[model samples]
Target chain A: MPANTLTDMILGFSVIIGILFLYILSLTLRFKQEKRKASLKNRRNIA
Target chain B: MINKPKLLTVFDILTALTLLGALALILFWTPVEITMGPVQKVFYFHVSAAWAGMLAFVAAGAAGAGYLITRKLHWDWVSLSAVEVGLVFGLIAILSGMIWAQPIWNTWWVWEPRLTTTAIMELIYLAYFILRSSLETPEKRARLSAVFAIISVITVPLTFFSIRLFRTIHPVVIAPGGGDSAFSMTPCMLRAFLISLGVFTILLVDLFWHRYRLAKLNYKNQTGEN
Candidate 1:
């Protein structure tokens, strides 16, 4: 029988997918913060 | 300025769906190897991630060249974005490779040529960020980083060729026949491997585009210009 490497496989994929998800999350959060700051700057300029 | 393009939205959806499909195909459709079992599944994505990471570095170098020629900040943005995205994929490749190695090579790390070269390559590109952050002027930052990006791309080929050139335990997947280090994939495995590569390429492009947009936004915000 093939060795039970299923756990290793799971760990590998989790790290891969988890890292990607974290990056996506970071991008979304940074974009939001930047957008808010830009909008607030525009508001202050208009006043 | 904050309004995102519809095309990017479409790309986002496409990337997500194709990635999910690729994962499903890898896990469900591909047959486990008789010798390596489930952990062998890691090879497909691991190699693909490494390929994507190398491609990113190549893109960064080309973009660096573009900036040097045109003296355009947009090309610098592209180069910066590629490096940022490349670092993430590189991290994924190294981490996944380590995870897979634990089961196969029976070790968490090895000082083999491939691994050593890859670590060096990653560090070299990572210095791009530190170099950028240190420069006060945008123009100076772009010029210096562009030069650094161009010079550091040498590591990509060094890391890639390390396996073929050196007698390392890292498997020679493409053009196999590095003696015991070669891995001859079956047709199904080859299909999944090719598809994984394609999916990862798409993912790289999507992430690079997003980063490019973020760079553009950051520039606009800091300069108070549209």
Candidate 2:
């Protein structure tokens, strides 16, 4: 085998992993933000 | 704070372990192709992502139909979450497919039926979001988006069969009658491919669950209901 396509394989895997990581990060951040807002809203209603 | 389910946590660990196992099998177990060399390894994840995306779209369509039949808000959430997650997997498949194509096809993209239909399917789902955003009321938004989701999913089967239906350079690995696939898979290669598909399926469910929770929270927040 020539094995010359190492670069392309690396690029493909990097892009797949990178996109998944970024998406998970976005989901986590949004979940936290939403939770905080909901809590604050509950507190205000109680007050 | 909403308590995380114990089963979800267990599923998270399972997905992570299976994904790591799949990667190790691809890197160390599968033999390198004499012609395509290392880049052939990309085939495992590339195909897996595309399969997962297709499954997600199917689920979304089913959920849409369920919403229409029952008029339940949970079905609406499931439909939206599946589409959203499906978009991510679709993007991965397209980008990875492009990378693989550049080396094999000597071009970044071609107007082949498979490629063209996949792009169109992605666009249709993208429009699904735009349609949802345009509506103000929850009832109207869910109803309209559910209809759109159901109709748009007709493209999923079209996209899947495009290579078989048309003359194209894209490889069809699992086609009937041993269609025009560029390469044949050995036992080890087949094992790795199956493992990758399984891992992606698990990941899809995990992400869909998370996204559904987010959608539920957003719905509750918007309507100020529990």
Candidate 3:
């Protein structure tokens, strides 16, 4: 139970959380892009 | 325009709350291990992510089988989403496991059976995506990817059982008989571990749903359909 092990724990948790954040961000950005594309296509079809 | 389902909205909130609760338990409630210390706490989320990744692969394989039987587009979407999400989770598990190992195993990497098999599993799924991208037609892509997904999932079980089957230094936390576990769990540690698993399971489902929606959107865009 050395105090230095705390650094490993922090690093481990940071990596996990950081990856999840990047993933969710990707999903969100992709979703928004798709929605915009779909809407523009619909607008052109109506015009 | 695709509408987000109300149930998914509810699920998103619930999953976030559960994940926070799991983190609280892992960090604050669980007692520190005598030998491994704080780094051992990473074990809760590391194993849970691995479990979730394995579950995702199973789901992908099942959905692939479903597509082969039914020739439905939805099944293909499910298969693709599961595989993609599974890859992300698997990567997290591997990286986190390596971090934990550095402190405990005195090394950052090892070519142990469990580690090697898991790496192979990740590569197989990566190959699945490559296979999909190389195909020209949607039908061919779907069909080929489905078949690949089904066949590659054989690695999942092999990866899971590798430690049990081989003489590896990797710890077997949950085993049928008393296993060569590196450390024994106290009741609080056990509770935190289970909670982390449950939260990750919920998170998997939530991510899968979002990924499936993205796949559906892509399919619609490809087909020139709203």
Candidate 4:
């Protein structure tokens, strides 16, 4: 049981950590986009 | 119009700190199970994912109710975001369970109550997205999706109870006399498990807040352009 599962452990850990990294990347991209949009709106108001 | 609030930035830092702490606790501090050995480490994250998945589903249901009462598009966005995130977490839970099971259960798939019910719940969540995608009008999509979200949540409790019942009838098949899904944890293991749950919940809240803010900004942009 334990012998065959080494790969499963690696796969499971990878998936969990990979998903976390993906979510963090997504958040960062979203923050940038929102900031740009806000700035654009501000410039529009000034013009 | 506004940046992420100060509280959210603080949450981002807290989330990072807690997640790193959880990893350290699980990888170094926790004891391995006698029966399951190293693979048992997956249990902490599996259970945590399940918790966050259910929490997201409940949030979707609540937001659906709010939309119905208020008839606000923002509530619809909240409901949609909750369901989307729930689907992602729920998929992780199911796949992680299957991966863990293959080592212990000698099979990649099981008709066990909990496993089966979770699979079914994931399906219902997938259907929610499909239902939303099929609609063209935003107002109609919001109303129909809200209705679907409310109606779909009814199956969650039923799925849970049915699985509990399924477990009762089947003789313990996989692990031992009690059941196939049993795991015995030492104090360190238990602490690691609890810590993982806390970290996952915090991560879920942080993501939800960000998703909601993005949706709100998109809405404001649309309204302003119009």
- Please tell me which predicted candidate would have the highest DockQ against the true structure: 1
> Clashes in model 1: which pairs?
none
> What are the per-residue Cα lDDT tens digits for candidate 2 across B1-226?
2567899899989988888888888989899988888988988999999999999999999999999999999999999999999999999999999999998889999999999999999999999999999999988898998999899889999999998888998898886567557457889898888889999999999999999999998888888886
**TM-score of each candidate's B chain against the true B chain:** 0.97, 0.97, 0.97, 0.87
Over the stretch B1-226, how does candidate 3's per-residue lDDT look in tens digits?
3899999999999999998888888898998888888998999999999999999999999999999999998999999999999999999999999999998999999999999999999999999999999999988888998999899889999999998888899998887666656457898888888889999999999999999999999889778876
Distance from true location, Cα of B210 in model 1, Å = 0.9
lDDT of 4 by residue, B58-131 (tens): 88998999998999898998998888778778878877877888877788887867777778889988999899
Clash total of candidate 1: 0
Runs off by more than 4 Å, candidate 3: A1-3
Query: Tens digits of per-residue lDDT for model 1 on A1-47?
Result: 88799999999999999999999999999888889878988998899
Worst ten-residue run, lDDT, model 3 chain B? B175-184
Chain A only: list TM-scores of all candidates. 0.93, 0.89, 0.90, 0.82
Q: Per-model C-alpha lDDT, please?
A: 0.92, 0.90, 0.92, 0.78
For candidate 1, lDDT tens digit of each residue in B1-226?
A: 4899999999999999999999999999999899778999988889999999999999999999999999999999999999999999999999999998998889999999999999999999988999999999999999999999999999999999998888888888986444666788889989999999999999999999888888998898899886
Displacement of residue A1 (Cα, Å) in model 3 is 4.9
Clashing pairs in 3: none
Model 1 local distance difference test score: 0.92
